[model samples]
Target: MSDILFSLPVEQQITPCLTLCKKDELPVIVINHPKAKGAISLQGAHVLSWQPEGEKPVLWLSPESNFKQGVAIRGGIPICWPWFGKAGDPMHGFARNQLWQLIAHDENDECVWLTFSLEDNEQTRILWPHSFSLIARIKMGETCEIELESHGDYSFTSALHTYLNIGDIDQISVSGLGPNYLDKVVGGEHTTADKKLTFSGLIDRIYTQPESFSVIADPANQRSIEIHHKNASDAVAWNPGAEVAKGMADMPDDGYKTMVCVETAYVTNARTVTNDKPQFLSATIRCHKNEQK
Candidate 1:
């Protein structure tokens, strides 16, 4: 249906390597072994606007405020789990920037698939000290899906931090959190979120055992992205609130008007994968042209 370019821009970089390619015709950008720790951007992908000029590009991942070592932003369809910001691993895990190689790229005149993988590196070990392999695959179509598999170690935890752009936060609400949840910020106690998790105050919550939940509606796009996940038992919603927004190095004062982070994870007390099994995390996002405003 579409002539997707399944190739990354090839060039040399001083830090590590920056590859910009297209998949199923959609721009797919990736970075390898990024040092000095910069940012990565893909064309048309919704990036976080931290300044008036939007310098930050809403990095698909970020380090947690406290644990500045792990990954945070899983750009595009930010998928976060495992740690779920419960630990001190920054925003999530460190798979985003750990030198991924283009393992497979194929186009059979119909659809395209682009896969990238990152094995345990000396640099990463210094920070995480875990032996593992992380793979990220991006496929294009009416609906795009990215699948992450933790194939090496079983005792691992992580998440996909998707920064969704929405209209007035007041107009949005997330459903499927069902009834009860454990609030990590308030006191690691259980509470009831029977209705949609509304946004109003400095809301930071982690929900467990979600049946099914779609991301908040986007008034600008006039269409909502339905988020579906499997194997992940934890979900987190975060907004810097007001006070933290002012002190942010990359977020604008009014930036709060447009975006929020919906992270999917396996956080509680951390999860370990045994039996040589691959822990899987995936997100499927389909955009509706008919719903476009």
Candidate 2:
């Protein structure tokens, strides 16, 4: 872990709330606001952690995550753009593996907002031949909000792959994803979702036209997490289980027991972005006491 501090254009505005530091040689922005605390890495513009005051962490991050360049950090929220998953060689697009510029930032009594931007370069064009500008705006406060916008003249599949923290995988239930989905673990077999989804083993399904919001009820933690999304045509639910997680070097074998991914996405159906009509995908997360339990 490197301890070198870097200077930002908005260094003065960042005082009393944010700091620019290096972690494992990658530039990171550490947030310490009155309402919340979090960290965002410039590499991929990935959000590594977030916790509202007086509450448990809302996101999950792998302890063994690599903080080096050109590698995807295993946790928090990863921005997958242009192409998602095996649509390209890098698995989940180049957006999350590239360094993004912090174009702007602001602070208010209730929230702190940071805007990061990435555009096509020779390296990115080599991976996917297209001209584009991507902007990720993050707001941290009592509630966490992330919005991704694309300006280009091309169609693409993307997702905000969010890994949520939970008390225990077995003690939680996720609801609001409608009845149908494509089961990826079964090689894309279509399946139906139960009223409330529970985890027992490897589960990977994509709900093409899910409801706009999903709630994770965690009785053991005495809280429920609500994920409200906008302009997303699909919702992805995933958990690798013990056997599959064992093969991953970044995540512990039992990591799946405490986390779940309910991603907001534009998969299965790609969205076309143009200069005249930019595309936007956003998700807002809030945690509340589990009143039912």
Winning model by lDDT: 2
RMSD of 1: 8.6
For all candidates in order, the CA lDDT equals: 0.51, 0.88
Evaluated against the true structure, the overall lDDT of model 1 is 0.51
Score residue 231 of candidate 2 by CA lDDT: 94
Give the per-residue lDDT of model 1 (tens digit) for 1-293.
00111133444332223345433223344432211111223321212111112112222222212112232222334434334453545445545433356667543332344576677778667766677766777554334456777766647666666666566667667766546577645767576745677777467776777655555665544656566666677776777766766677556655565667666666765667664677787765444332333
Task: Count clashing residue pairs per candidate.
Answer: 39, 0
Task: List model 2 lDDT by residue over 128-218, tens digit each.
Answer: 8999999999999999999999998999999999999898999999998878888888776465646888898999888876888999998
Evaluated with TM-score, which candidate comes out highest? 2
TM-scores vs. true structure, each candidate: 0.70, 0.94
